[model samples]
Target chain A: MADEAGAAKERKILVAVDESEESMYALTWCLKNVSVSSNSKDTLILLYVMPPRTVYTALDGTGYLFSSDIMATMQKYSNDVADCVIEKSKRMCREQVQDVKVETIIEHGDPRDAICQVAEKLHVDMLVMGSHGYGLIKRAFLGSVSNHCAQNVKCPVLIVKRPKASSGSS
Target chain B: MADEAGAAKERKILVAVDESEESMYALTWCLKNVSVSSNSKDTLILLYVMPPRTVYTALDGTGYLFSSDIMATMQKYSNDVADCVIEKSKRMCREQVQDVKVETIIEHGDPRDAICQVAEKLHVDMLVMGSHGYGLIKRAFLGSVSNHCAQNVKCPVLIVKRPKASSGSS
Candidate 1:
């Protein structure tokens, strides 16, 4: 119980990734910034949400038709995406921060919902993500994943923008 | 110039939106929480960043072919996303607060980058977002966007978590 209590105080950092360049940049930044000391355990959690798949079976005016294999295929695809993100994260962690423990999670649901659920479950110290502006119409049409996460999570959220390589260029 | 200057100082609240349920919740929270006085100008800037098109373009042998059309399309999309976010923001502002001016901005770039840039340009007092935890593997893979922003940006960031719908759920 003492050991467990000690572990609870550890600083947990949660990161959201979509395999985008900005996401990659965010991952790299976390490794460099978070430090683990004897007193404080620093853990990093990487999360990827699989786009939810809903099936619509056709009815021949009488009853239900046949179910498709798309759901299975999508689950496999989601697992594959998680695997890829994990592999990359591991490699980067190994190269950047040697002492920190890294964890990976993959879920299927609304990206915002999944993220909030995970963050609460873990009770992390902070949540971090990368953002790119989405225009009004597209945002209305599609939705902003980061915005949802920011609004729902209780911890402090750090949003990293791609660093200007040069101030002169937009 | 006087009107523009007055507008700038009116305690602007910039809420980043991506049209997600969590973001909308944050928008609602912001509307309910932030106060506006007659002497103060409360402006809510709904910012959206369109993911860069170059990310999708095939690298091919040429290596990152930049197209003018794609840039234009991205800008248009960014504007649309901002517009959608602004509409919701305004509605909330109207319902929740008084004597407030709401504005929206859309940019084509990384979301994190766009947000920080706007915050600085507008000299906003604070930034509000949501936190979603990525699982262990992904956390290791992607790092944390909020952490990165906290380290880099000058303003204070507020990360909101979803409230438990019921006490039993907690």
Candidate 2:
């Protein structure tokens, strides 16, 4: 336990990003706050976990599948979106805290499993995520992402919440 | 936004605690990290939001009334739990970081709304909480508490995830 706590002193922060505004807000908050001063030397990893793509099977459930061409097209689209989000996060890091080293990882799997697996594999000191996500229905799923990640991960998780429509909280 | 960011420089962290082990772990984690260094000077407010206890009401569509004695007993029980949790958290602060100013607030209402309301009212720099309160059934509710607090609160929220049964995570 002491060793685990000691390792935490040197921050290896992981920020889970998607195309959610909440996630972007969390990344910004982390840069301006959690990763500061001495923490600037720490690596802030931007992780984007894309759910494993599943090609649609035949309506008859007879093992017929989508054409390889269609499957490839969808896969390419997912990768493109991942790249865009990562690039935008990198820019935010650059603009917010120039010293903190930033890295990116794009994984394919259940986001809950992928995130916890990556964070554990990296032995990150902390897992930072945003509260909600793109839509109301998606927000509930994102909530599960954070909830599962929090329960499964070893390190402390910082879930930055995005203010509601009012923006009168502060 | 700049003014909000400026105000955040002085860390006013709030940790929401209950009788759950997960919450205790989170409070301990916050003491060891978030409230460290210059943050010691920053105030650490330990908040315990007790859900309003519903006293037994007479079963009728009319003016139902629970006996005052029964109501008083239940309220006292609720208050006792709140006090016990708060006292335990205060002890953690004393043992962990004596320099960090520790304060406590006990509020009776819906845990979700009460937490967000208190955080907004206090304009805390950050809100730290535990994930997965009791079990799977309770988790859905606690998830909403963290989710609601994160979405509704003004400050960045940290939901500390407790290690799972396997504990193979680094």
How does candidate 2 fare on TM-score?
A: 0.73
- What tens digits encode model 2's per-residue C-alpha lDDT throughout A69-153? 7666777888898999999999988887878899999998777888899999998879998765434665465556775775678
Q: Write the per-residue lDDT of candidate 1 for residues A1-170, one digit (tens) a residue.
A: 11221232466878887666666665665554333222135788888776665422222223445334654565677678778977887787666667777788877666678888998899886677766423334346557766666666765565655555422345
lDDT of all the models against the reference?
A: 0.59, 0.75
Q: Write candidate 1's Cα lDDT for B125-156 as tens digits.
A: 55765433222343365455444454456544
For model 1, give the interface RMSD: 13.9
Model 2, position A42: C-alpha lDDT score = 82
- Let me know the TM-score candidate 1 reaches against the reference structure: 0.44
Clashes of 2: 0
Off by over 4 Å in 1: A1-9, A35-40, A55-75, A133-142, A164-170, B1-170
Alpha-carbon RMSD, candidate 2: 5.4
| Per-model tally of clashing residue pairs | 58, 0
RMSD of each: 19.2, 5.4
Q: Which candidate has the top score in DockQ?
A: 2
Candidate 2's iRMSD = 3.3
